[model samples]
Target chain A: MALRNAVAQAAVSVRYVVQRFSLALLVAAAIGVMLIGKADTVLLERARAAALDLAAPLLEALSRPVATINRLIADVEDLANLRAENARLREENARLVTWQSVARRMEVENAELRGLLNFKEGPQATFITARVVGDSGSAFVRSMLLNVGRSGGVTSGQAVVTGEGLIGRITEVGESWARVLLLSDLSFRLPVLVERSREPAILTGDNSQLPRLAMTQSLAGIQVGDRIVTSGHGGSFPVGIPVGVVSSVGEGGVRVKPLGDVLRVEFVRVVDYGITGLVTGPAPPPEVYGPPAPPPRAAATKAR
Target chain B: MGDFLQQLDRWLYAALPGTLVAFLILLTLAPVRLPEVLAVAPLLPLMAVYHFCLFRAEALPAWLLFGLGILFDLLQGGPGTPVGVSALQFLLVRQAILGNQKYLVEVSFTFIWFGYAVLSAVAVALSWCAVSLLMWRFIDPQPAVFQYVVSLFLYPIFGWLIGRGRGRDPLNAPDPRVPGSRP
Candidate 1:
């Protein structure tokens, strides 16, 4: 009996030891994952992709009712504003009649000018529209998962936009889903031009409501309401895609409010410009950028 | 056969807490597009961890918390935090709570909630510090502060639901908050 008691007691001790060991080992494994995250290895990317593929269907199913409810709410709000909207639309329609003839005349003039210059057109951008199944960002990221992926011919670093303007770009793709890193994410940096002033600047997200302008020659050159567009400097994003308008300029920083309401956007277009150049930005945050991040900003700063 | 069926029933009951917490984790990742909803969604799974740690430690173990945290990071599609950051934070928070589990369990409901409010602040601050360190830049503190507020505000609902479940579980000890209750 004593022998049996000793054996049982020993068994319990061993089990306790094993449980403690396993807990410590799992904690170590988690830290190892964080350390290796920046490496952005193929194995890591594949693991993330596999996980994304598994979750996409579940997210897609869950988002449907949410989207429907949102539309219902928006419809109610629209109804509330209908009378005011109708009066405003009528006034806008009368003003648009004056601009319609001017636009037609400019189109003819633009065609003649292009013919005289013998200018070839830029590459036609082909795109696939994807439903945003999840805005998966928590505290650290500002990214959304899309319903299109490898099977849909979606590739990494493609520009994602809505009809209103640029929103962000695809940073990762799985078998049937992709993650777009949003313009308001801290990791996002884009080469953009002030459409009116033509002064070049970099738009960098600080995880705020609006992203700030960086690397501009002069903040004085940028003013409130000046349009921001992709500069096509690195040949990744297509030239002249509207991004946002300068919404503020002061001691706080120059900020651009994205034209598209990226947070609430239901669908986004992933456009393939047929150019596979590096994603435009240096030291692009993390492996989210498919290409290995280049070393610090020395070369990019000099080039600018 | 009766004994075997009883054993199976007991096993299934033991699994319920983890399963419920897992579902809550998945719910947070769902694409709820209400304005500011995603930005300020309460950290639901963490609430589950806190509850289970105090009352039903056998059901949601430390290793389970580690796994759920990693899953949260993956679902978040983390930029600076693809993995491990949250897992480490959960383990740290779990350790802190479990170390004080005896006194915490013996306290009144209000006292328990106060303990949670304090611990959760530390928990959120730990994650903010950890992710900021990983990024090598200080991230905005605004979202984290908002998340903490919503989480605290919603705690009573979450705790009441889970507390009722704890009372119903035959394997669990009596609720300390119940007057005349004894361990």
Candidate 2:
């Protein structure tokens, strides 16, 4: 009986030691993975895409009920404020009607000027509509997964927009799913220009409601309520796409309130302007070195 | 017949933990939006790890915790950000909880809640630090704060669900699998 007890205790000890050792190894491996991921290996990208492809269908099915519930809630809220909304819409519609004539006149004048200047037309953009099936839901990253992918011609770097305004751009695409890096993500940056001044600047996201403007040559003429639009410097996005309006210029710096309501985005249009080729082309091959020199001329010609 | 019955019992026991892990994965993937409340949803998997650590540590082994964290990191962090942050965070939380298992047993629900609060705060802080170091910039802390508050409020609901699955009050019963523990 004492021998059996000793054997049991030994087994338990071994098991405990094994568990602790394995845990330590796992922690080390996790850190190693984080380090390697910073290099952005092709294997990691493919694995992420594959995982997203597998999870997309399940996420779509799971999100349907959520979408339905959200729609129901929105409908109920609309009904509750129907009369006030109707009055507001009527006033806005009347104002829009007056502006319509002015916009028509400007459009005609703009076309005439373009023709006189012999301005070249840009590539016509096509769009693919997609539903948002999931979000990262982490505080560190601002991204959402859409139920569309390469199969739908949604490629990386395509501009994503709602009917309201610019939402973000596609950063990763799987077989049947894509991830949109939102304008509110900390790493997001884009070239933007103020409409009134046409002064160019960088719009940078800091995981906040309002993204800040940076790298402007001068903030002298920039002011609150100025419209911000894509300057299209990198050729990844088309020019003149409305992004947001300057919301505030405080101690925190100038902030732009995005026109698209990212929190309520159910569907978005992935716009392909046919300019991705300029940004992502095949890399040039490394220059091949000639064959190595003959080893040291056999070491003894002079002595011989 | 005896061997078959024993095998079936083993499978059933494994299924309980497997299902919980699968559920946690699905919750992470689900896009349940509550715009008025938060921009980012609460961390459901963190709550699951916390609950199992207190009530069913054997169900959640260290390796499994590590695997779940790795999966989360892969899905959560894109190419722009460093991965494995969540995995390391989860592993540390699991280790800390398991190491304190002795003192944790027989503790009141309030004390357990407080413990979870501290664990979650640590997890959030770790993630923030990891991300800031990786990006070389300090990220906004508002979303992390919101996630912490939301997860804390949502914990009791998950705890109740876990308790129901055990078919007993987790607070009242000591886990039988834990050696030298009493019910």
Candidate 3:
């Protein structure tokens, strides 16, 4: 009788524990869902800090192995020697010399035109160089984190570029790190103009692993391989920053092959277009209704 | 007075270092490329979630995991990157694991493996769909759609490894938060 009573009591206790525990867990989970839905920058910062702290040791531990392997690979490449590379470069250099002569002539002409035209000098852009600390490991997100942060004069919305061209912009700035939103990201939108036709279009990404050109009017003249550069209309990105070349153009949309390899980003420069003077000139008085003007000719046509 | 101070000191130590070490290993190994099927490896976050959920639920609170998801979002700055969605998926999976803990506890490796395969597939699919909807693309889910299949395929092997690894290690003593062990 005693043994049976003990067994019955234990079963009841186990059931009670499981039931109570699960109820508590369910309630906690609901609250967790609500909190996650409202995720914000503050939350992101904390998580990043924690991750950095956690990852520091691992990074330190793996750093040596990675360095050694890289060094060995470099030595092997060196042994394979610069002979083949030199041959390729010589061929490329011969072709570039002809292009360089033309480019020089064009520069001289451009200088003369600038002398004749009374164009105001735009402010020079300043840049702060940073090393990439961590990479986005998610396939869905194309972003990178840099070691430079608020302390390093990094600010949100600053353009991040490389020697090649525009990469992305800094979206989040922590004390010691900043996150760059790559141009390839689905959320990224840039005002770009075709280099050849000077046709303005919005570069939008659909998260299809490639960004597409949207709102492109007069696509009849546009062709694949045309270079796209930033249009400084909205003053977001500086004008004429090389974005990419048109890879594929279709009735649906045009795809751009971005200049930056985003995957292998090691170093990045954050443009420090520091404090600008406020628009001192008063806003033009509200425009009175006026007759619409004639359509303007293509800018590229006039330039040519 | 000496004994009291010693006891107080003992209360201050914890298992946080070990947990952080594990997380660091996971982060370093997390793949960061596109074409999810090609560049990224298996779910590092899922591994963390499983470790914490089963072994130390108190350490990885829901809020903490939610924040981790956003960190991923900020790191991934592209549009439609769903930090909130992924967090929700982790939360749901954890809950399911907890809900079925009674049966799961008694099950063999095969059952656990199959369970993870199905659960991980659902999670990855939900995440991909969320990303697609955010981007306003109804395009073919090819390539990336296969990630779920991969996750399912890898589930059994990963589950066995996790189970075996955990079993091999000593259980975290009840008072893991306590400092020096008592005599």
Candidate 4:
């Protein structure tokens, strides 16, 4: 009896000692994991994908309620704006009639030109719509997770958009979930063309609501409210997709207000332009890196 | 039958802290996309960690805290949020809770809230430093500031909700830090 009791007492003391020192060991382990994550992206992405897959069921169930609640909020806001919205729609319909005729003429002209030039039609864009089930809520990185994943034909580097405009693109894709890097993420870099000015610039997200324009061919033509669209220079995204509008132009640097509210995106369409073997982060294309040559050479060549 | 019931009850009490923390972490992942809410979603999991570690240390131990932290990071945390970063923050909270146990327990809500605010600042600073160190550039600190502020303001409501079950077996075991202390 005495021998057993002594052994138990010794074990208890040893346990206490281990428990006291365990915090340091645990903290070190945590730091070590972060270092590994920083060093090896593939491993980190795999781990992230697996983790999301494990949590998807609960996230799916929880997201339904959240979606319902958001719809309720939207309904209340819609009710408040009903009168103004009706008037706006009436005016929009009248404007659309004129634009429709303009669009019909352009379509006829474009088809005639294509036939004359024997221009090959690009493959039809394949898009999969996914529900927004996860929000990164990250301060440094702006992103969200969609319920659709590789299983739903989602691959990293595909463009994601809504009816309003381009919101972001897929950065990491798992079996059942894919994370889209938002336009406002610091790592975001897109080669876009100013629709009116026909100037090419790199849209750089600095974790701000208004991303700044960098490497513009000429800022003289860039004015407030100028529209921006993906130049498709890198070929990751299809050409002519609307991105945002120039919100400010000053010495502080040109800033753009991304079209549509990114945070409020409920359903996003992930589009594959038949481009694969994508590099994540889609580094600014080598072509766009040189000194500003001339204005919109790509568009000018296409116009002929 | 009674023995089986008792065994189940004991197991539940053991699992309660981890389960609560996990649920809150999941809640943070939910897509509550009100304007500014996605960017400034309160760090609900951090507040839960603080509440449980401070009040229920006996139930939520360091290893469990570390695991919970890992889960928090993996569940759509952030690109800035590397896998083990939240684990480090959580383990730090646990260490602080243990070291300051003598002063933290049986304290008023205001006092605990103040302590929590200080802890939040430290945790956010640690995250900022870790991310800067990893990325090898100074990140915009605005998001960190916003995260800290939101987490701070929302702690009271979290505290009240987590505190509801405090009446049930919040056993403050003997502090191992002090050489010879009793519960």
Candidate 5:
């Protein structure tokens, strides 16, 4: 009786397998037809986005230990190499002091110059700090996961920057995690203006460490080491924020040396901008200089 | 009722090995970076299918293979891409091997690996072309070329290792028709 029962159970299982197999085949065929009729990049993108959503929290947890170990190793190395580092630090400090003095004098001079030349602050921006927790190291795309997410007020398209300069923008936001598509990603494009020449160009990444500067009107006035800043042409980033410096120049193109260290990023700031409510409002005008001069309208009427 | 339970146990047992094989293949494929040779390893799923077809054909049917493909597609994070297409290709190859089991079993391991390499390459190329077409532009071909060559180069070594390890498992037990093998 036991043997007979076992055989019956086996037959039931086989039946289940057959049923499921047929269903899967049908689904596969349906998918194939859809794929052939017209490829769906959006659907595949959604699937990938879903997978990333699931993996983000797990990746954040995984990155904790690596960060801890890296910190510990760096501490140990610092201790072991204390004497040399001390000398290096001393030299750096001295240079910083000199720079500080120069900076102060330059700041006073700049303020005076602004008063004379009427230069003005561009826009108002708010910021929130976040930490980098995960990196997707695929060659086809460049993105890193941040611990801050929707809960922290990070939303898709919000700009991320660092002490050095512009990093990337938030592309995907989960409840407590977000993905930043770094400026070096193949899909990322930013409007930029050269600091020296003010010539506009589109910075495009090709999944490489160095993103290329495209759409340049003329490379004649540009030089290596020239500063690049957000143009604010798209209203995405506040203008004049440092993006990167030109590292290479060619007949038709240039490459940027990104300010942020894409390889070893640990923390980033998510600029809140908080301007969702005022999206259509004109940006507040710059403060009047030269001992609080008359309002622009009054001055214009007086001149007339 | 008892018979149903027994069948459930058998199917569950059969599925475990394939799942483990899939997991290991994924683990190896996960951290592959360049500047080191063998950066992106070969089409690991093809190897998995090949193994099951050779040793435990009943465990991994075409449907399971297809599901595995779709799962990988989802995980690879490139949407609109159908991983099932390549998986279906693996199923076809397995079926071909099964149809000529008697003749296929007689071939040497080297020939078997060579056949797998060709089959896997074709499948990979097809899936890649499908994705490229879907995305609406031709992406650079360097990455695909790198993945194909590396996978093909390593398949033989991996095949040999799997063959040697298949010795102790009852499911991987040599066919009763092979001379000197116990039933």
Candidate 6:
């Protein structure tokens, strides 16, 4: 009985030791992974892409029921608001009829001006419509996974938009999936121009619902309700894509109300404007451009 | 035949709980695009980790916890690329719970919930610190705060589900530390 008790105690001790050793090893491994991941190695990127490719289909399957339920709820809400919605739509249609004639006149005048100026037309943009299959859903990151990827001609750096306005851009692409970094992500930045003053500025995101404008050349004429549009500075996005309107300006600086409702982004248009070459395009001939033009003295004086 | 059957039974008993944990992690990663839910989705897998660590420590080994955490970080891509920040946080939580298992094992539901709230807060704070350190910038803490509150509310629902799956009423189950009370 003494020997048996000794053996049992020994076995228990061995088990305890094994468990403790494994636990320590796992902790070490976790730290090691963190260190390695800090490198942002290509291997990690490939692995992430592969994992996302495999998971996208499953996420699509899981989301269908959720989508259906949401649609049903929306249908009920729509039914309740049907009469009011119809009246609003009628009013909007009447207003749109008047605006349509003005738009036609503007289009004719803009074409005539373009013809007079001998303006060069930009490349036509092609779009790929995709469904959002997955999202990071963490407060720490704002990104969504699309069902279409390389197979669907979706590429990184393409602008993602909805019918409403600019939503974000594709950052990572796999064979069958892509990740879109929303405009509300902390790292997102874009060059924008105010429609009224043509003032250049940077639109920056701080992971809030409303992104803010920064680095404006002049906020002189900028005010609440001013329209903001892409400046096409980087050539990643086309010029004049309406982004948002200046919602508020205060000690906190200018905040924009993004035209896109990111919360309800069911389908998105991934647009490639073929502007990648423009960034790397050769400089215009010296004779055609002559010497560098002098900075506007008025702008410099305003800075002083 | 009896020996083979017993071995299979042992394997199932050991693997089932961990597999369920993995399933919940996968479910959390799925894109259930409920409006505004994405901004503050409850950390369902954290609840699973807390549940298994408190009631069935033997099933939730350290390596399994680490693996789940790594999967979560990878799936939830971030600005600086996710490393093992989540894994470390989970490991810390599991270890803390395991160390205090003696007191925690027999606690009532309210105490367990309170314990979870505290541990989860610690985990989120640690994660925030790790991410901030990784990015070399202080990240906004509002999202983590919102996530914490959402996860707290989700705990009881998940706890009830987990209890139901184990074929025991969470409110009336015998003390799990007792030998015969568990499978």
Q: How far does residue A124 in candidate 1 sit from its true spot (Å)? A: 0.7
Summing lDDT over every window of 10 consecutive residues in candidate 5 chain B, give the lowest-scoring window: B27-36
Error of 3 at A63 (Å): 7.5
Question: Model 1: per-residue lDDT, tens digit, A35-128?
Answer: 7875665656676676677778888888788789878876776799999999999999999998999999999999999999999987889999
A72-156 per-residue lDDT for model 5 (tens digits)? 7557766998999999999999999999999999999999999999887755788878877655432244566788888888777
Residue-wise lDDT of candidate 3 within A1-304, one digit each (tens)?
9999999999999989876675456445544543453455456456555655545344445544544554565557656977988898899999999999999999999888888996675667888998665555555665666767888888777788998888887876766767787787656778899999999999876545568888889778678899999886655456788988898888668988888666544578987765321211233355657886445576456667
Candidate 2, TM-score of its B chain: 0.83
Question: DockQ score for model 2, please?
Answer: 0.47
Write one digit per residue (lDDT tens) for candidate 3, span B1-183.
967765654443234423552454345343233332444445656655654565556556655655555444444434445446656666667777766777766667677667766777777777777766655566345434555566556656655655554432223433545665343
The digit string of per-residue lDDT tens for model 4 on A1-304 reads 9999999999999999888778888888888888888888878778887888898878888999999998888788789999999999999999999999999999999999999999988656888999999888667778888898888899888899998899988988878888889999878889899998778899998887899999997779999999999988767788888999899999979999999576677888998888653454555455666677566888699788
* Error at B116, model 2, angstroms: 0.8
Error of 6 at A35 (Å): 2.8
Give me the candidate number with maximum lDDT. Answer: 4
Candidate 1: true contacts recovered, fraction: 0.61
DockQ-best of 3 and 4:
4
For model 5, how does the per-residue alpha-carbon lDDT over B1-183 read when each residue is reduced to its tens digit?
866866675566666657865664344323222223443435666667776787677777766766666555544432223445555665666666777688666688777877777776776676656656665666555555676777777777877776764554443544877776642
Better of 2 and 5 by TM-score: 2
Worst 10 residues of 6 chain A by lDDT: A277-286
Docking class of 5: incorrect
On a 0 to 100 scale, what is the lDDT of residue B96 in model 1?
Answer: 75
**Predicted structure 3, TM vs. truth:** 0.68
Ordered from best to worst TM-score, the candidate numbers read 4, 2, 1, 6, 3, 5
Best by DockQ: 4
**TM-score for chain A, prediction 1:** 0.82
Superposed model 2: Cα runs more than 4 Å off: A1-17, A108-118, A281-304, B1-13, B79-81, B168-183
Clashing pairs in 5: A9-B3, A9-B4, A44-B79, A44-B80, A45-B79, B42-B151
Question: Which candidate leads in TM-score?
Answer: 4
